[model samples]
Target chain A: MKQSALLDHPFGARYAAALPAADAARQDARETLALEGLPGPKREEWRFTPLRGLAKIPFIPAASADDIDVCDLPADVPRFTDAHRIVLVNGVYRADLSDTASETGLTVTEAKTPDHGVDAPLAVLNAAYMSGGVTISVRGVVAKPVHLVSIGAAGAEPAAFHPRLAIAVAPAAKLTILETHHGLPGQPYFSNPVTTISVGTAGVLRRYVLVREDSEAFHLATTVADVAADAKFDAFHLGLGGALVRQEISVDFVGEGAAVRLNGAYALMGRAHHDFTTFMNHDMPNCTSSQVFKGVVDGESRGVYQGRVLVARHAQKTDGQQLHKALFLSRGPQIDCKPELEIYADDVKCAHGATTGELDPDHLFYLAARGIDPQAARLLLVQGFLADALENVDDAVVRDILSGEISGWLMRKASA
Target chain B: MALLEIKNLHVSVGGKKILNGISLALNAGEVHAIMGPNGTGKSTLSNVIAGRDGYDVTEGQVLLDGQDILAMEADERARAGVFLAFQYPVEIPGVTTSAFLKTAINAKRRAEGKPEIDAMEFLKLVKAKQKLLSMPDDMIKRALNVGFSGGEKKRAEVLQMTLLEPRVAILDETDSGLDIDALKIVSEGVNTLRGPDRTFLIITHYQRLLNYIVPDHVHVLVGGRVVASGGKELAEQLEAEGYARYLSAA
Candidate 1:
């Protein structure tokens, strides 16, 4: 409800001079950001979660922040020994710490600075301060997954950075992309990343993202995927930790018979807040899209899930379904779930559902009666509650690691 | 010494009296059957003994190994060697049956200061006991009782009983959903666990189960009170003659 200046974070001519993309068209992005500030409480999309905390912080551009040491990956990162990894720190590529040379069907290069083309408020901000990212092109079937690790660390002052990723999969190609976003402890760092993906006809793209930022960090990520005819885009988004984090995904069914499965799960505690907003545009006929998101909130935390599916009039036979369920660990936490379906096609089958409830006492009692104590019983149930969504991750190794991470979060909550 | 003793137990559910001044004692290794017509607090007594919630003991005490179990949580009582085979075994999805059984076994071990069961040994034991119950080899791989048939649910309950090896086991209408074949396999499973260190309280509405795992003593409860107490013969008598006489007598 507080009205503040749109340029509260201070991005002026001096700020643009320090950016990595010197040749990028900066005037349009700056003007766009100047026109549209951070989303406020009045906007329905930002109603439940307030960005007042972000507006209050004096976040300098990450390009201007001291060169954070990029010697090692975060200790919490799951080292997938089988996958080829690409490392980035403070939005800039870190070739010194990368293992991408052995990868096949992957060519990593610098991405063009993003354009502010009638995008959302956060996307505009990402454009205005875009720093550095890579473009990955895939052809044929990739034997190993391509892992993208983005690390953020602030020095001396609070900092913010926007990393842009562009991906293209050739026709009949198959690839898996694993992304992890982590930051060092201390400092309220802000990370905004925009990812654009294009899956050619009959191509297959499997994406798995694990976001674990600092307890005081802010992460606003937007991902746009364009699926061609008969292409399959399967993705799982896992939100583990952050002070203010929102992972928004938009899928455009650009070709007929395309299929998309977007599933995610979040486990949050303390004052941490997370939101998963998805928009699936069914522009072509006979396409299918499904979204399943589950979360657990504790310690006065807040969780949100907003899903919208739009089916055009000509997009007949569009099968779209979405469900969001949140489990509250304590009375102090809050959950806001909104599921919207706008279907213009009469032959489409679209269903959206949202459920927010505390742990089922019956389930808890059943576990307890089997000799598991209340705490462990609750933990087991929470794991089970999020299992269906976690099952979306097709890779066995990644699935196990994510499940382990969730268990660790639950243990921390128990001890806290 | 009695392994379990229910002394003048008066239980109420949701402020309504279900059990009125019930008294019973079972020494270790004894199998006692509590039977009656429907709505006679047969299941209520079993639930109260297992430390289930929603049932308030308005009076009296239920003790296990001389320790007052009514004051303990359901899980505490379970770790202290109390088991309840729910009439309707809950279908817990995502937590596999093997995982639940392992946790239960580990819980008992932890309470007794014993090392946790080795995973291989645990699997071998489950396989052997599951064979006794005629359960499928992959039954343990499925989520705990989820999507299982009526008979499979009852069999899974008996499987948990076989694994936990509690000191005092309460089978609350375990025969309710089972067919005659499942009943035989489940009863055979229970009969194998009969030993000097363990005891059983089988609560049922029918005496058909008593034919398989014969009880040492049978008590006929009516109107929340034990109206008749006899040996296994009482079960047969009750089966032959309906509880009409006892219902009116109470």
Candidate 2:
């Protein structure tokens, strides 16, 4: 995957000088990408889902694609009428299509450079070309959720966009954020985004993310969240589409008594490849973190779940658990699951499990005995299998939306 | 014509003969109870009739209104008005009981050229059936049979039977894991479904459930064959003497 096939976007010479806040960090990230290009298959982390297809693409820095005009939010955006909306196209915030009514206890400002420890290649790539991101700071409990919709589109030529977002919740604050990553149906587009979240003392942050890129799109997103003492952070990531999509998340518990629940589900068909790589760093004692991820693959697609829970030497009484289960809808598909637990503390408790299999014949027979035809029975069972992991989603509306998306996928699969 | 007929039905599971030449004729409006001892192929008869997989009908004929039901798929037989309330209903996680009920009911309804049941109509029908089975309203809201007590599973089975109202209902050990109250409630639900157009084959080891639903005819099954057949008094006779007489005859 790392063969100098795809040329680098000039962040130092072309874009970094104009971008505010993280100019130096952007240069550093570009250097990191230059030093460590997209990790090859030899790297154990990238062994499951290689970036050969990504490397073959002639992706120009999305910033250079000035002709890529995003006039409106894509039609596939899940409509939640209650939540306030914030729209971003090609990494730039579009105020005209956004709704910020009665958004008290919330302040949305210009993009600020993200300083989340030194370099992951994609994180640095996001910083190098980062533009059109928002800094959302919350002081008090927000009544309604703030919906962030990031749209990606390329014109005649293949393009890419790097969107940055920094979210901070003050002490004793409560907030819910729903992000829908969508793309227009045209030329192939690459969306590389970095999102950083900071939760304060005793604060609660519930975030749900949906990545539904177009079939011809590439999306590599990195999300970093720091949870303070007595704080609770719950996130559910849903990866539905994209040519080459990777959602890498790092959740660090900075203070004792913090809790983090990261759960996600993905359904892929055709030749799509999706990778969900998560790192739960327990730097403080008495922190509990759990992750449950499930996926369904069909039509020669591949899926990978790489979950690593790192418990530091001083982080005693830390409880970390992760489980990944995948269902194969067809014989052509492949799934790779790696659950790594690096526990350096003796008093720490950790567990990990991974299972990959097809639908149970007994379950199918039970459904068939109830008069559900095999096709319909399969749809119901597949929906149910993913629904088990979707139970982690607490929000009713988002859960319904995710369910509808799955149904949509199923119907499409059936028709295909 | 009999509503259902099993003619010389011989079934084998994995090369071993389970049901050997068990023939029975169930007329419309008749409630026939099959009382048998352990290892007597009680469930094999029901599964073979209902068209379950794995059990090979080496030589047999399971007829629904004189049409060969063994030739049809399990779901096809179901759409043909054959229902088997499983002895041990499966626990299917994530598929809600309400949804399962609606799908099964609608599948039959669709076969009859009826539209899919609307939400309100479905809710009303389910609510009424739940009330009939004395099942709690929220019972259907949970996953099908998952985390349910033994009584709840059997009651759910009866609830499904009441909803589907098949022309031929086979209650296969429906009273196996029931306590006194669940047995009464489940028997009452089955009793309510009994009618002139419907025929029932109640499979049970004990004669207790026959007291609740009062079969018109009782057949003694032992060693994979119907050793004897008679009126309701035969069930009483078996209860008194146990199946030792029938067990020896085979």
Candidate 3:
């Protein structure tokens, strides 16, 4: 193994001593993290989103902070009807707070040590010091959806935790999962979570993620999915709160005739910063992928979206599309959007679009003419703008929940 | 006193005069029509009364029920019982017509210190009104005015006027793009709302609409001023002569 030059980095010797002794896999990942420190503004992929704020904080491991204890889920977390609830506090699964009933053809277990390497800086950090996670295996069509709620809190000092999650769906099986990431308001806490998903041939998986961490928290999540022949992967991500948050998702088609739909929406205010980075790799023939992301920025907040779609030489009959749109509520906010398509195959269909604009005065005046107040009119227009993206969510129940969350955010903004 | 009185209304758009010394009084239980050529400030008159921005009111006072409405914002004026039926209703995507209607109704109700309309009650009310306007039941399910035909948009305006029951309703070219059947239906909807407490100010460049909903009074607007005022015959005379005499006189 090559020696790491970044010994003084945050994820280096400073916090590495607090974690348990690492095995070979963790050691290899630690070496990788040391070699390539946290992404900075110099990096092309992370130019818009600088991690210097996160790097400046002196964060100790959450496991070493014994003073923090969360015995109950936050009241703000929605109670999904007829869904299995799994709770995670500071990255460790809490059985006492979970109400997961064992269903047929589905099994859940504690995730093992990291054995696979994901080529991302954050994933490398997560592999180095992952505290705890869950491995969910689906063997047949599951009747009820699974809800995984991750909560973060720091007591007496800024803390950080890395969690690893793995999901596998057998051939011809189907499942749906909803993940909600939340945190309490206190000393800043950082959550670094890595999720690996695999869908067998002809299987289906629907994943919905909602990240609404506390305003003083930082969350960086990495999700990589491998899809096989004729499988379908549908996912929607909704970001509402966090001081600084980045959700990076990448999908690779390993077999022919697979399809993927990755869509997301975000609302930011105050000094919050949110970034969404997506990569779609079509290495097989007859594969399709589409992405649609929208955001609303207010106050002095910032929003960024970077999408990269790649079609290999042999990947004929590939179809890929991406679009990003943002609305600004005030002059103090900033938005950055970049879409890159690298297509090497001639027989492929690819397109991308990005737009940034303020609310239309005509629409506002029209609503105002109907006796709707100015604030109420703006809320309606913003919701209408986001509705275009939210409509992509296939499930009506989940769509309603996400819409309610957006309304709540808007109400808070109005009051603030 | 007239229900809606406009006194010496002088309006300008972008520092250029549009309506110069325009005066009219619409009495209670009366329907008044203002007919003029295309550039005669008919739409400006309606827009100024509706409190749209960007129109500098150099010297004017629009009184609704004896309260000056020019000092109010567009939405405040709307809640104060002023409605303007747009010629081109805005197409707002993702906002269902049902939601917008409920919100508008609730805003008016709240202003009047009344409880908001419940879902069932609102549904019943809107369904009845929609039927009267000959609108399909699923029209409310779509986005507000999005993908709606011209006739549908006009009918929707009538539906809103009926639901709000404003004291003074100004229709800006309501007959512009309507077919004969749509015109009859829209006129019928407006005629049903005519009563002792309601007043109508119908602004149009054509007299064909007056044939269906005959006005109690007609005024000929030429060169930003009302050069002539008479009872229903003026609309017919202007239509027959095509405003040529009045345009030359102004």
Best by DockQ: 3
Which of the two, 1 or 3, has more TM-score? Answer: 1
| Model 3: per-residue Cα lDDT over A147-184, one tens digit each | 99999999999999998888899988999998999999
Residue B20's lDDT in candidate 1: 96
User: Best-fitting candidate, measured by lDDT?
Assistant: 3
- lDDT of each prediction vs. the true structure? 0.86, 0.86, 0.91
| Reproduced native contacts, each prediction | 0.55, 0.52, 0.70
Q: State the fraction of real interface contacts model 1 keeps.
A: 0.55
Give candidate 3's whole-model lDDT. 0.91
The better-scoring model by lDDT among 2 and 3 is: 3
- Model 1: runs farther than 4 Å from truth? A1-7, A12-14, A20-24, A115-118
Return the number of clashes found in candidate 1.
0
Query: After superposition, which runs of candidate 2 have C-alpha atoms over 4 Å from their true positions?
Result: A1-22, A112-118
TM-score of chain B of 1: 0.97
lDDT of 1: 0.86
Q: What is the lDDT of residue A337 in candidate 2?
A: 87
- Candidate 1 residue-wise lDDT, A106-137, digit = tens: 78897656753537678777777778898889
Off by over 4 Å in 3: A1-8
The candidates' interface RMSDs, in order, read: 1.2, 1.1, 0.7
Kindly list the per-residue Cα lDDT of model 3 for residues B1-250, writing each as its tens digit. 8899999999999999999998899989999999999999998898889889899999978888788889899999999888999988999887889989999999999999999999999999999999999999999988899999999999999999999999889999999899999999999999999999988999998999999999999998887899999999989888788988888888
